[model samples]
Each structure stands twice: as C-alpha cells, then as structure tokens.
Target: MPVIVVEVMPKPELLDPQGKAVAGALHRLGISDISGVRIGKRFEVTVDEVTDAVLAEVTKLADDMFSNSVIEDVVSISVHPAPASA
Candidate 1:
C-alpha cells in the first residue's frame, strides 16, 4: 500500500477564525512576534498504488468531499511507498 497525505487549507484571501483565535491567544501569552496563523486539514489515505489516474481521482475527491471548494484549496498529495514488511 502507498500512503497518501492530502493537505487542505483556506485560501490566502479568506479569513480563518480558528487561526485568528490561536494567534490572539498566543499574543496574550506574550508571543507578539507571531502575527498570524492559518489552520488547515490533512487527510492520510493508504492505497494499493500511486498512479496518474489515482492522483486525478484523489484531486476530484479532495475538491468534492474533503475540502471547501469556495474557501479552501488542496495544497498537495504526498505518496509514500509501502514498507517491504507489509
């Protein structure tokens, strides 16, 4: 099996409430230098293989099911080869 990791994040122009809250909390804790934060999602999936067709399907799924099409974007999909022991 190949391990696939999909990362989704809010568009840079969009406001992230969770990220803002975290930044605010950090500021109150005397972390002023850290001015911003952006919250995101990561999905890890294991598949039998890594191929062009699989990548395309994964992109579609990411757009339709895993991420908010309007405000979020899929950053990347990392594929790791299966372990020999498995």
Candidate 2:
C-alpha cells in the first residue's frame, strides 16, 4: 500500500476562526505575543498505488470532499511507498 498526505489550509487572505480562538486562549494564558495563527487539515490515505492517475483522482476527491477552493488551499500532495516486510 501507498500513503497519500494531504495538507489543506485557508488562503492567505481568508479568515481562520479556529486559529483565532486558539490564539485568543493563548493570549489569556499569558502568551500575548503569539499572532497569525492559522488552522489547517491533514489527511493520510492508504491506497494500493501512487500513480499520477491515482493522485489526480485523489486530488479531485480532496477538492470536493475535503476542501473548499474558494477560501482554502492545498499545501502539498505527497505519496509515500509502503514499508517493506520486517
């Protein structure tokens, strides 16, 4: 099996509510210097192959199921080969 890693995040100009909330909590906890916190999603998928066609299909799935292109971005799409027998 192969593994696909997907990192999804908001565009630079988009607002991140979850990140803002965490930043606020950090500030209340005495970490007032923290700023520009952004939240994102990471997905690891196990598949039987890691070919261009497969990756393209997965990318489509990510666009449809995992992210909204209007305000979100995909940082990376990486495929790792499965580990060999021990």
Task: Give all TM-scores, in the order shown.
Answer: 0.87, 0.84
Clashes of each: 0, 0
Please provide, for model 1 over 45-68, each residue's C-alpha lDDT reduced to its tens digit, 9 standing for 90 to 100.
Answer: 877898998888887898899998
Task: Give residue 56's error in model 1 in angstroms.
Answer: 1.9
Model 2 alpha-carbon drift over 4 Å, by segment: none
Lowest summed lDDT over 10 consecutive residues: which window, candidate 2? 77-86
Tens digit of lDDT per residue, candidate 2, span 1-86?
88999999999787799999898889889996787588999999888888888899999988888888998988888887888861
Clashing pairs in 2: none
Model 1, position 32, has a per-residue lDDT of: 78
